[model samples]
Target chain A: MTAQPDQNTAKARTFISVDAMGGDQGPAAVVAGCLISAKANDEIAFILHGPEATLSPLVSKHPILAERTTIRDAVGIVTMEDKPSQVVRTGKDTSMWSAIESVRSGEASVAVSCGNTGALMALSMIRLRKLPGVNRPAIAVLYPSSNAQGFNVMLDVGADIRADADDLLRYALMGASYARNGLNVDTPRIGLLNVGTEEHKGRTELKEAYDLIRKQEQKAGFEFVGFVEGGDISGSKADVIVTDGFTGNIAIKTGEGTASLIGRRLKEAFKYSLLSQLASLLAYTSLMRLQKKIDPRRVNGGVFLGLNGTVVKSHGSADATGVSAAIKLAAQLVENGFNDKLAARVAAILPTEESPQE
Target chain B: MTAQPDQNTAKARTFISVDAMGGDQGPAAVVAGCLISAKANDEIAFILHGPEATLSPLVSKHPILAERTTIRDAVGIVTMEDKPSQVVRTGKDTSMWSAIESVRSGEASVAVSCGNTGALMALSMIRLRKLPGVNRPAIAVLYPSSNAQGFNVMLDVGADIRADADDLLRYALMGASYARNGLNVDTPRIGLLNVGTEEHKGRTELKEAYDLIRKQEQKAGFEFVGFVEGGDISGSKADVIVTDGFTGNIAIKTGEGTASLIGRRLKEAFKYSLLSQLASLLAYTSLMRLQKKIDPRRVNGGVFLGLNGTVVKSHGSADATGVSAAIKLAAQLVENGFNDKLAARVAAILPTEESPQE
Candidate 1:
């Protein structure tokens, strides 16, 4: 697609604010994505915040963008190489902090960033705070499927590494909301990713987490399925999969690596001999299709859920296409009012004043 | 592939013992696999071990099988469903135990099983004992790759969970030795799998392990490469990647899941409509080629390296083809004297006086 400059999508109630200098691709891709969103649907407003020196030139090219897109400049906060511990002290002046704070202040409905993940998370927790009834936040990502248009959502990809049973339940609830709002799946099937599918598998924490998920209060509108193995991440057995960030990150990266390996190896094999080249040529179209299915850039990135507002964490190594995808996802989340619905759902599950801690 | 009778196989130096009751496919697939191996490679032997009541009649159709095959009737053993703690107590008279003993007693060169991994691991650790200069035994397997005829080789798939710095170094040495003798890769480059390739990145275990690998007592006939990501598993960047079993297991399972997913998705995408189906039909030969390239079953299983004698573990759910591959790998490991080479190599790396401590 063509990414053009635009001030406003359609006259919609929701607005998605994106970090102007986030991600490895810089602001051009995000700007292009905003332009693309305007060309397609006009129901969302694009809020871009970052260094004006780098973003304004890209925005000025598209004459139609003057009214459709608005920009805010931040002094600057975090970089991909910044230390996670440093985000807390230095985020006051960073673009990521400014972008997130915009959502918290209600100037924008949601915020997205492809900057330092740890910094984004740290700033989000400090600025957005937890949704009233939630504990820690979760990062939910959608892995695109080629045969199917819908995506499988993995929660807590890199946010909450060491999670307990209750944390897992909250992750599931958030993931379900993500699946429903992002993909529009009706009653998304949620599964807890574990070492085994058997009831008695996984470590003690996972076992306890399994029971916690089964509690009536935790299984909200979505179908809380049983255990899922690493295999389920690729297949369409579940729309939403909940796991600690450590395993989820590894799973996502492993899938990405394997797909890339497939693509690269096939290319290398094609160069080996004439017969192989002929075979590779024959399979070219199919390989291209499969690549699209596994392409990290096309799938965009994941959204860090459970924050007071919106904050999308794109991989630092992601390319222009990936940045564009993140921009689109941020818009979708904002237009869908994901946070409000998520907060409402979470409040219903959390123990209230009447049901004080046991 | 036709499986020769046990006697026929025994006549050749390439004798391989198989546990008939192991794996999800059970006896039928194991029997079929034995026949296939015996028939395909005349130099290979199939020392079938299981209940005589179950095996004798299966090969009775070919009267010539009497001279070729022999059955060692085992009354009982550990089932895959059994817990690891009870494997030894309950599997006293089992086929799995008997098969491993065959290798120890020189009755067979290698014992291959596709049974409960936990049980197999516990039994092997106790029965085989660690080789000289080896701290802990590791289970290493070959992954199907696009670079060579097969996939990349990796170690510590699931044998030990909590690997220390020294254990990783030992695994690297064993994997390097296996690559040199078994895969015939001279001066094989070994890599440590971590979250990032940078020296300071990843969990503390990884960072410590990386330093030891990069600056440890150098081993002969091996190149110590730096850290690699999950992508390298398929990229052929390094032949052997050393890590704790937990992460390795996750990576392998995730890779398998993704490869299957990519294949399924491409098929669906190709068949989405009349137009796509036309493209798919045109690319059928290519699709077949891709499937063959990424088939996990073809890799079959991995060897429990660092054991006193050779032992190979097949996937619990392997089919006849998978079992056949495992049998071949075990036989090859014996023929190559893989353990002997690894023992000699590792012995030279450490002090002889500390051998007892190791």
Candidate 2:
């Protein structure tokens, strides 16, 4: 039986479409993450996509999740090895596709998935499509920083390998919006990533992007701090760093590798001798605090910007905590109306042309 | 009058040209570093460039340094703020220029400087010129890694923003040579930096470079590991990582920034509470060992390759230890005949073309 929808109750509820397979631990981790998220936020609901037989049992393990979830049968799974192009052509029955379709059909406010990044992005682009005036969609990520909010927004982290001056300008606009709504920073300071802070440095395209982004200071509602170097990514220099996908992708990976290297060295140092072992025990509390502060799982989402619907990509190897963190981020973005506001902002700034087909 | 050179003794001696001014701490650190190297190695000597009045007193501070150093008068100091273009026009009197001229005129085997990067590279290109068959020169730096040798070599860290297939091939050749001689890596494994390891990933130029580099495995005397991502830079997977200057520059800077951030956070954790403060005291020895292992000063020089003469760029803010490390690297390269060997390797692999003037 259908009942009349209560406007206040309906507005308060937020539905998240989730791909319940393809993560490192399969559907179990995804369901566990959803349970954690649902317990934390009572208003959150999910439309889980995967093989109904496998996902339903996992959902029933948590009574609360079983009450707040709806399972959709999707037998096909997009594995990490699947090519993005191939996925686009024949991935309609996969959980990733079904999850994205829910967002496109307005059945869910946002989509979150722990799957093949390339395939997920490809399916997202093809299904949700780009917003009007959007040249190319970008992947905006949160980098640990010494800022008040403890994070900085960096964009184009492997969504595309190339970006012209105009694309960079669009990144600045969308990245600033994300920093404002997601990171809760007002008038976010945006910087163009380059080899040096000097205006004469870097590629010619960077110089042109600098000029374009500078002109949009008033309209885009961001403080253009000119060009910033790589150190600014972790330093308290800027709230948003814009770069082409190639450099950003490499830079982010390099940062992760360095962190891992140092972390391994630190552990070795702590285990060097009995005295050091005792010291580590005494310092356990503070060490745990430091570890929690830098845990990658706490910041697991890479939001796909410049698209009509919001899509959050969780790390492929993410555990339950990481998946929950991603869902939390997606919920925050949905509540803030990030996609609609970003689309409106882009439309207002750039000259309207025929929107490109996916 | 100069005495007749004793063939064996003269061949054993290696002269390093040092720019003793415009560093963060000026001539004192340079003189101190030279003293350390002079005492540590009897065959090393220096051509110290700076105002004699300023450098003579510092050289006298260490009696060993005074005996091994030859002071040259260069009144003009190329400050860090000097523009590269401006320096090219009228910087002949600067210490940086004089130091490089020593190598150019065959008075010194190699040049080492802690001055502005752009100006130093500009002067080096103008004075040393590119080796025949070389498209563009690259800056190769030793990064701390988990390898048994404790380092990996990465190139084009900020030399030029672009690298074609040929340029990348040259980087692989040059980088492998440095890894063998500088890091003592035998038959070094070279990896091309990309966003992913897949053949289909990265830009069009990278795929072309992959194919070109693959053909040079036997000729260059190195193993090609196809494509590697940013994580491989610090991992033990490769001895040499090569990429265009733009990505390499950002990657290196991001790595440094991440290390700094983690180092700071660790120190904060150690000082968080009274119990942790006590633990810090107990772990001082192991902590110091860890610090010494990852110290930037131990690997201080960035060797400029693809040029006729060797030029080493020390960090602008290098201390005495850092300067000594750079000098040690230059001595090793000179002993290995790195420049001559690199030139021969390039000629053997590619058709010789008319060299381009800077």
Q: How many residue pairs clash in each candidate?
A: 35, 0
Per-prediction TM-score, please?
A: 0.86, 0.96
**Residue-wise C-alpha lDDT for candidate 2, range A116-168, written one tens digit per residue:** 99998888888889987777899999998888898899999999999999899
- Give the backbone clash total of model 2: 0
What CAPRI-style quality would you assign to candidate 1?
Answer: acceptable
DockQ (Cα-based) for each candidate: 0.35, 0.80
- Model 1 global lDDT (CA atoms, 0 to 1): 0.74
The list of candidate 1 runs beyond 4 A from truth reads A1-13, A74-79, A86-94, A132-135, A144-149, A216-219, A265-294, A315-321, A345-358, B1-12, B60-68, B75-80, B132-136, B145-150, B272-285, B344-358
> Candidate 2: what lDDT?
0.89
Residues B1-47 of candidate 1: C-alpha lDDT, one tens digit per residue: 14443334435557677888877877778877777776766666656
Return the TM-score for chain B, candidate 2. 0.95
